[model samples]
Target: MEPFTIYEQQMQRKLTRWGIRLQKEPNLLERASKSIQNRINQVIPDKIHTTITATVKGIVQTTLFGITYMPKTDPLRGVSMADRDAKAEELLSLYKKIAAAEGAGTGAGGILLGLADFPILIGIKLKFLFELAHVYGYSTHDYRERLFILYVFQLAFSSAKKKPELLHTIKNWPAISQTFPPAADVMKQVNWLQLQQEYRDTIDFRKMLQLIPGIGAVVGAWANFGLLEELGVAGMNCYRMRNLQDKAAELADK
Candidate 1:
């Protein structure tokens, strides 16, 4: 099968596994994914000669055996020069290939991003369900930030070649679905200590979590998910990947 078809099939399995249903309407996640790809492509310098320049001038005779030469030049549009444009175009094309390579390297994470707001967006639809979990005396932690984090983590971690079991954990979710706390339960006092502690602890865990090779994506996804909640998903996905790409590049250099 063609690569795109294979990707589609794999993506479908992931969405289905997460219990996120894809609709016939415009695919926001797909659009966001493309946007990320575009942003990633921007980091690469498309041309090298664009930075260099040369100028020419005339010479004036000062004395019998002495002459002074001066150079006067008009600046040309960098891209207008043949050498610059050719180098830039070639570099830009190569950069695109590199972006594709990095993207291919990020397996499940790519799928999750493509799914867009799978967990969080779907969570909005299932708000009642999460609230129900809390009202019935379940720990609200999982449904709130924890669950949100889990979903984002799924997005980030999913992109690695060595897929994490967490994806599978969330996939066959029924086994631990009830472990999530409900809204009412979260509002209660009995479980405050544990959840509060967990909340505080997760802050640090997030830092450590993001450093892991495959785990960076999960942490990133969770961060994005939280940002989406704070700032709409569209806004969250908008500028975040550029920051991520830079960080990744910096790390690669180290």
Candidate 2:
């Protein structure tokens, strides 16, 4: 009956629908495409696969764990969910523009710059996630929190086949994460091969177009902008599910 209660209801419905969508089986076209990709991957040299896996793992680990690159952000303590959501929208708007600009710049430079966009775009996305985590009042200073950020990143960008399991894990992250004690090496838990392959498979088609000399700029900007848009929605909704579900559980206890 109350305004806050109604808002929570809306969020609950949204999260439920999103959960259902995440569980969708990959469609026919997707399966076919994946088959083709897999065939291609099988033919690629093992050394090349190893190199790519190593490169992606290095980039993620460096960006995620490097204290120097960590954004100086603090939790938005004691804020109402509505206020936090509004602030998150503002932050996402800023990041979207930054991504678009970077995409355009690199795309205009042709193949070399386009090739360079992988790490650069990933850096922007990671930075945005750090800021987003703070917006939702979560501190990334803890190992699990950084792991949470990575999970959210994968949720938004990983292959469709991986989505259902990822969604389930994220939904139960508070409990699932605890199985790993503080001393456990977070990096060791990650499936680095899955991480790199799914991420590459997810974005390869559109991102590859950005390497073209002529249309590269336009494609780059569009693709980068869309990436943020998807991530923005996922980030906000994932946080809402966690926050709202926790609050509900607390009320139930009371």
For every candidate, C-alpha RMSD to the true structure in Å = 27.8, 2.1
The whole-model lDDT of each prediction reads: 0.32, 0.84
lDDT (10s digit) by residue, model 2, range 1-254: 12346777888888899889889998899999898878877887989678878888887787556774466867778777888889999999999999999999999999989978888888888888888888888887876777788889999988788888889988998889788755247677789888888887878788989998899999999989999999999999989888886686777777
Off by over 4 Å in 1: 1-148, 154-162, 180-254
Superposed model 2: Cα runs more than 4 Å off: 1-4
- Give the CA lDDT, 0 to 100, for residue 73 in model 2: 63
Model 2 earns a TM-score of 0.93
Among these predictions, the greatest lDDT belongs to 2
**How many backbone overlaps does candidate 1 show?**
13
lDDT of 2 at 167: 92
